[model samples]
Structure formats: structure tokens, C-alpha cells
Target: MTYCVGMLLDKGLVLMSDTRTNSGVDNISVFRKMHTWSIAGERVITILTAGNLATTQAVISQLEERNKAPSDRRPSIMEAPTMFQVATQVGRLLRDVIEGRQDGGMQGEGPRFTASMIVAGQIRDMEPRLFLIYPEGNFIEASYDTPFFQIGETKYGRPILLRGYDRRMTFEDAVKLLMVSFDSTLAANLSVGLPFDLQVLERDRFDPLHSRRILASDPYFHQISSGWSEALRQAFHSLPSYSFAEDSTPSDGAR
Candidate 1:
């Protein structure tokens, strides 16, 4: 499993994803789940994926092939007139890959394949946007009420975004928010691990403002995880407690 979030804010866009893949306690590995594409100042996009690894990989590979093709026949993400069209192309590609794999195997189970993606970015003249693409190739955009999208093992990290995220937050604050969110997820689920990929795109830049691969021992992440844990513990203790009076036969002494 994986954990990824794409957040849209008034300042810009923040994309984050963990790289861990776990099948069991002993079966563990790391593979990058975040991918990006750009055309200098014309357009930029990022995609974070979850669900069956094989299916996701194949879909991405197919997309890459088209991009690598010579001349104008490459079916353009870079040249798409609008961000919406780019998303449509990606959605259609995802659906094709899923269908091709599932139907290619003629049997009852048909080689089970399902995947979802969080896509975010902007074109030269368009506003930054975030989308959560479902396994069915449909997607929903992030809105003011909910300015973020998460994919895979999201429950544990969702609350932090829900509580603290705001449209006007700075790009710096957005990264911290994502780190705390990932921190909560790391504690509750073993499938999502560290060595995360993070990117921040300032609005209208049409490029990544900052990008980093956070390792297992990265100091900033370590600080965020530890600090958030301590804060949670402190908050829990500070809350007023409801205690049942000790069950005792005190009346017997009076009798």
C-alpha cells in the first residue's frame, strides 16, 4: 500500500507520497509512487498512485511511451489546451490499462487490477488544481470546502488535513501539515513507510518550487513525527477526564 496527498491552496500546490510497499511483516520494499511531467514554462503535472503495483506501473509505462514518441503524434499532455483536457487523457489512459489487463486474462478472477491516482498541477494560463482519480477512471476536483485529496491508507492521516488545512496557508505550512498527516499514518499502519517524495509548486510558476526525497533518517521528518506524537499525548492528558467513583460499600460503614 501507499499514502499520497495532493493539496490545492491559494498560494500553490503540495504533493506528497510515501514509497513503501509491504506484503507482510517480512515482505517489504520501496518503489517511487510519485511521477511528474513538464514542458519548461508551458505546463507541469504530478501524479501519485496507489493500489495494485503492477497495474499502476504498466499504466505509467504506457503513458511514458506516448510521451517519448517522436513528432506531434505523442497525444500531448504538454500541449493540452487546458488542465481539464490533460486530466481527461490521463483518466482515459488509466481506464484503458485497467481494462486491457483485466480482460486479457480470460478467466473468473481475470487477474484482478484496480488502481487510483491523485493528479495535480497547472498549465501556463490555468489555475493550479488537484484531483483524485478513482479506479473507474472518474475523478473529482478539490474545492474550497475540501482543498486536498488523499489516496491509499488515508484514514490515519486524514484528520490532520481536515483540522488544519486552509486555502490561504503558505507553501511552507502545507509541507508541515502533510508531514504530520504522514506521521499519524506511519504510526497506525505498517504498509506506508518513509523515504517519502515531496513537491511544492507555487501558483503560476508552472514548475516545482521545491522537491525532495525524504529518507528514513531525515531530520525534519523525524522532528515532525516525534513532535506530533508528543503533542498528541500532551493534548490527551490535558483534556478533562470522566472518572467513575470507586465502586465501594461505603454505606456499610455508616450502617
Candidate 2:
């Protein structure tokens, strides 16, 4: 249904999410899958969503409403004291919305309320942190052994990250690796399409360093896609050739 990745590096954080929603072969549309809340020079938080659109929207809407109310409610993400508390609030809200909607009181066959999110950011006095929240309200943080998180149609694009990802890599290299990873996923999954959203938050800056939307017609994305495909082809062709000159198997080889 989507492709969202949150990569934690020594430098900061890189988050990207596709903007495609597909219900059937003939039903397709674009909806932004990334949302950010930031108080420049104070704190920043980004959320990437995947799964049932209604459920995700409702959860976000509820949070936004709470933030806009009479100022007596809990602080919004922009005012949160810690990234962990922000994530905790969001996870609880998501679970409550899904469970409330699934009680089957409104009508028969209640609308599917399944969704997950990747949340990342840094508080003014804390280090950058990244988290992946599951549909059930539980979450896990990025660790040294696995410094990245992915949700939705992730299998296709995951291999590149597995081979190239490292906490020591620079921000520029991390962006390139993610572009390839997203490119691979785009090529293989119909449910995930472009108009990608990316955000980079440098460590301890308490602000976003870079944020942009990449459209389907963007030249850089096209170049990355084409270049990666060509590189793969060349690598395949360069592999050592193993041929049987006499059409007879070697004694050490399987018969």
C-alpha cells in the first residue's frame, strides 16, 4: 500500500514516504503520506503513515484538533518535551481511534481500521531518535545493529539498505542509498507510486535541515532510476562466465 523509510544515522535522520493510494486496477490516487510538526530551532517531528487511509486520517485529524483546542489540552508535538513522549502520545491516539471505530456500533462490517506509523525527531535537549509504531500501539527504536525502519511495501527496496546502510555513512550517501531503495520498491509495487516526500533533520539542530517533495517527472529521480538499472545490468554482465567447453561436468561439480 505504501513505502515509508526512516533511517537513523550518526549525522541525523532521513525519512521518505510515497504518495499513492490504490483500491483497485482502475481506482488510484495520490495522498501525502508524510506529516511534520516543527518549531524551528526548538524541536521537530515527522510521521510517515501506511495502511487504511480512513484510519490514518482520523488519527491525524484527532491529534490536530487537540492541538487547536482551547489550550487546556496536552501540548502538541511542537511543544512536547521529549521525542519519546511525543511518540507515546501518537501511538496511544492511533490505537484508540482504530479501536473506537472497530466497535461495530455504527454499521455492519466496520471500515477496516489498520494503520502504522514511523515517527522520528529530536527535542531541544535530547539526541535524535527514530521509532516504528505498529498497529497495536507498540513501538521499537532503531538500534546500532539495525539503524533503519520501513513500513508498507518494503520488501523490494530493503535489500539495497541491507547491503549499503551504515551508521557512519554521511547524510549525502544516506540520501542516495534511500533513493535507490525507494526506486527499487517503486519498480516492483503497484500500490506504491511517486510524488515522494523527504525530510532530513540534523542532529541537535532541533530543526529540519532539508525537506522536499519529489514528483514523478523529477529529473533527479529519473536519473537515479535509470542509472541504477543500468548499473545492475552491467554488474550482471561482468560476472565471471562458467562454461563447460567439452559439455562434460567436472568431477568436483554436482552431476
lDDT values, one for every candidate? 0.85, 0.86
lDDT of 1 by residue, 92-115 (tens): 888888887778763465335778
> Would you list the clashing residue pairs of candidate 2?
none
Instruction: Output candidate 2 Cα RMSD.
Output: 3.6
List RMSD in Å for every model shown.
5.2, 3.6
| lDDT tens per residue, model 2, 137-199 | 888888878899999998999989999998989888988899999999988888888899988
Error at 167, model 1, angstroms: 1.1
* Model 2 ranges off by over 4 Å: 106-111, 243-255
- Residue 211 error for model 2, in Å? 1.0
